[model samples]
Target: MVSYGLEEKTALMTSLTDKLASTENSLIESTGRLDRIKEAFHRSEARYHSLEEMERNLEGYQEGVKSILLSKGGDTSPLAGIHGIVADFLDIITPAPNIPNRDNIEGELQAEKVIEAVLGERLQNIVVEGQEDTKKAIEFLKSNCAGRTTFIPKRPRPEKYRIEGKALQQLSNISGVIGPAMTFIEFREGYEALAEYFFSDVVIVDKLETALNLLKETNSSYTFVTIDGEVVESSGRITGGISNGKSPGLIQKRRELRALKNELLRLEREVSGTEGEVERAKNEKVLLQVQIENINKQIHEETIRIVNIDKDIEALIDDEKRIQLRIETLCLEERGIDSEISNLSSELNIYNEEIQRLLAEQAEGEQEIQGLIESQKLGRERWEEAQRGITTRKLELATRKEKRESLSVRLKELGERIESATTLTTDKEESLSKIDQKIDGYLREKSGIESTITDLWQKKDAISKEIVAKENERAGREERQRLSEEELKEKRRVMEDIKKEINQFEIQKAEIRLETGHLKETIYTTYQINLEEEIKNLNLKDLNIDELTSSLTALKERLNRMGPVNLASIEEYQELNQRYEFLTSQESDLTQACETLHKTISKINMTTREMFLNTFNIINEKFQYLFQLFFQGGESKLVLTDENNVLDSGIEIFAQPPGKKVSQLALLSGGEKALTAISLIFATFLARPTPFCVLDEIDAPLDEVNTERFINSVKDMTGFSQFIIITHNKRTMEA
Candidate 1:
């Protein structure tokens, strides 16, 4: 048994004391929780009153709404225009009732008739000029001045007089042929016919003889025969005073009078018919006007009734709208109350759950308390038992301590006896000195061995480094050889391709040469010389043959470099190799350049992206602010960013003012988002002006201020660019 000192005993007491404190604190916390549970049961009366009031209001309102809605009858009225009231009612009716459909055919026809009556006649008139010759209509006389100038009343120049009289009769007959008559006059004597003809025609010699006589008597070089108002004929050769004849006959004037009378009669008939038609149209129009007035009066009365019906309908609709609003409001209120009730129920559930949890906790706490009481009673008994055990240990410790004191005294005497033995101490000290010297020599030898090992390690490292360098050099040389071999292989491939191409070209050239009879030899010689020169220029010996052969031998161990010979000859092979090397070098340079350019472009794009975004954001925000300033509250967006292709990547401005949800720009009224969006867009245009801006009807949707804003934006833009805005807006035009 080991004895515990006072210090150990004190530590055990402090540990027990700490455990007691922790247990007591747990018990106190449990007691406090029970107290809080007791307090909650006393404060739940106020919540019930509020819920009761809300429930009562909701009930009363619901009843009031149902009573009001059930107290109206349906209204009846006829609707006009393209559709009817009955159709609208049919659309509204849920379950169709057994009723006959109304017939409105006559009403539709009447409406059509009214429209037609209002629009007058659709008649058209056209005038065409008359083609008939009116020469016979104006009175003019003609007479022979050959011998009639001095023949007072003696012989009267009877022959010429008869000829002139007959000619006048023919002219009169021709006037009858002017309109509605088939009058033809072949002169009784051919002389008169030829004399009266307007155009030249063959006639008998009598007319020529008379013409000569007249010419002789009158002593005139030419003569003209006048019929009515027309000069019907002219003798190319005539003479004397008959050239200027007068008072040829009385028939010409009478023929003119007859033609005038016929035309006048025709005009009188036309005027009478026109007058009758005018009178008929006037009477019809008047009757239609009277009918229209009567119908208008009836329509006015009907319209008044309809307007009253419409007002009633409007009132009914308003009532319905208000009722619907009220009902909806009531429903909302009920729903709100129900939600509140639900929330209360959730709260009550929470409370119930809390109470149940508290009760469970209380029950568990009571059980724990009962257990603690039992444990405390048991622990107290155990602690008292331990106190008894400690008293027993103390008795045992007293006995053990007495034994230890006696042993210590004996040990002190032995230590003094050992200190008095001097000879043995001197021997041990000498031996210890020798051992220390041996240890020092051994340490020095170890130090020398360590230096040798370090030197060896340095030498080994140098050898290892040299070996590694040699290996690396060898590997690099091997890799170069391999690369050279690959170049040879690639060159051979290109040579093969060129050989195939040249072969094909030669085949084509041969065919062409065969067709060229005289030029074949010349063409072939030129092509052969070109091939020979190309073959001669290839320096096959300049390449590192041994290194290439060694690499090829090594490569053969892994893979076959030359599987088959597709090329024709070594010349083609060498030429193809040179071409391949040139192409490969060019390809590598291009690839590297492309990579560098791609990186540079990517960096530039990254830098410009931030700048573009910043500009876009600035423009987007400014435009939106300006749009809102004009529109009060709506949204606008950058339909396009600062990208060059605006139309391809155009963004749309979506404007929906506060409380509105639809995004359709068209659905907004003329005064709403249109002007705002237009102003914003124009402002954006001003920010980045181009060569020319063409605006078509952009200002057609704006008010004065918004229009002014747009125009000012345009004017501002015009400081740099040409602008052509097509607009019907007066303010835009004026601006």
Candidate 2:
């Protein structure tokens, strides 16, 4: 029995241990399941939330795209002329093949040359205008020229009009002579003028050389020679008028003639001597000719360069023609490309529109799907909560079952002990007697154990009640979890259906976009219009108009805040600014002028002030004596009271009556103040009177005693200024 009891005890302990382990394992498994369900529910919730958000964003985006499309006007208007000009300017200014090259300068030069040559060949002419002698001279000239020259008409000068449009004047004659005869009769203008007659502002000729040659051959015996339009004459070459009828006069005249003839003979001899001079002149002329030749060579080189430039110009013109042809070809190609671009632009617009529509439809569908997804998330959360409650209830039931089993085993053990003790009592009487105390103690233990069993039974009953409540709650939670799960599944199924619908809508959208693209391409190709560019331009215009309206409103508000602007005030303000500026500038000038004046005046003042101080000191010494005559004994001095001292200081007259201790001007009477003030002003004036001073009633307050002293001082100051005195006293005025 002991062994059996021990075995039962060990088994019971092992069972409790196994039960606890199993419960722990089951709890772990259930907790893990619950955690996995919750994780799944969270992921699903996140997916549903994201889908809902995306649906909302897509809806807003779709609306924005529609508004953008509607804002742009349809392609219905042609571009303005200025717009075309702007486009052309952009195309021409861009670095493209169609722009004219810089070599166009050469082409223009070639055209000019051609025009000039044509004009020249058409206008060249010849003329002749003299009688027999002139003809004989002309023949002589022509023969001597040896085919080297041709005659041209001479242009009239301003002074020549007085001489019947002739080319010669009394002071200056100009005619061309292409000859070597060295005769004045054979002179005529040259031929180059005829070819280019009307083109020049001035008629050019070989006037200097011809003038020198004409002077040499002329009949006048004065032998006037001009070079480069300047004349140098020797003394007394002109034959002055003679006094007639006197023998001496006639002899003198003959002597004069003889002398003139002798002078001519001497000049003839000198003319021969002039071979060296001529040689020297010829050498100098050779140098000048060389310079002229160099200049002519340069001119000829320039002419040839001009001719080559003309050839290059012709080549460039030809290149320009070729380029124009190429430009035309490029324009044709560009037209074709423009047509294609127009078609593509229209097609792209249609695609964009269809894309917009599809996006809108997709947004609506996705919104519905998102709503379903949100509902599903709520359902999943409910299901998860319910599942947690069911798991908790199951755990509670398992725990209650464990406690009940423990209670039942204790009750069975107590009943078995009572039965075993009654059977063993008679067989072991003596042993039992010895164990009576132990039995009493065992009885007490039994009672305590029974009470414990009763308490345990009560506890078991309470636990059973809790288990029933838990079972009910668990069943309710299971039902709720099943219902929530069913709803979640339904929402998921609905979402899937929506997704399928969206896929179908997407396919429809793709088909519509394709058809729209094809239709747009057909319409664009037929119309040759850039619908997309038109729409883009319209969009820009709309944006600009909106911005302009906003700006205008803001400007109006600001204008309102500022109130009415006074135009006259504005003009006056402008005038004032101008005047102020002028004044400021004048002030600046005056400041500089004042600085100079200040320096000069300062010097004058310094000298004059010092002189006045010295002179005042001397006068004060004399004035003080005159005052002492009135007061018997007194001291007087002049003092300055300010730094500038222009008006601050004055002459002071101190007087003390006989037997008085002090001498102060304040101690004097009113008549004395007037007399003393007048004397001081006069003495100060004697120092520096400037131009003029006025005395108004200077002796009105003075008595006769002091008035006499003031009059004497005024008479003393008469050397300094022109004084005007307003006084009632005739004696004072007379003084």
Model 2 stretches astray by more than 4 angstroms: 1-44, 47-49, 52-432, 526-735
Task: Please estimate how well model 1 matches the true structure, expressed as its whole-model Cα lDDT.
Answer: 0.43
TM-score of 2: 0.19
418-509 per-residue lDDT for model 1 (tens digits): 44333444555565566556555544544543454454346446645755775586567546645654564465467559768967996897
For every candidate structure, what is the RMSD over all alpha carbons to the true structure, in angstroms?
55.7, 66.4
Best by lDDT: 2
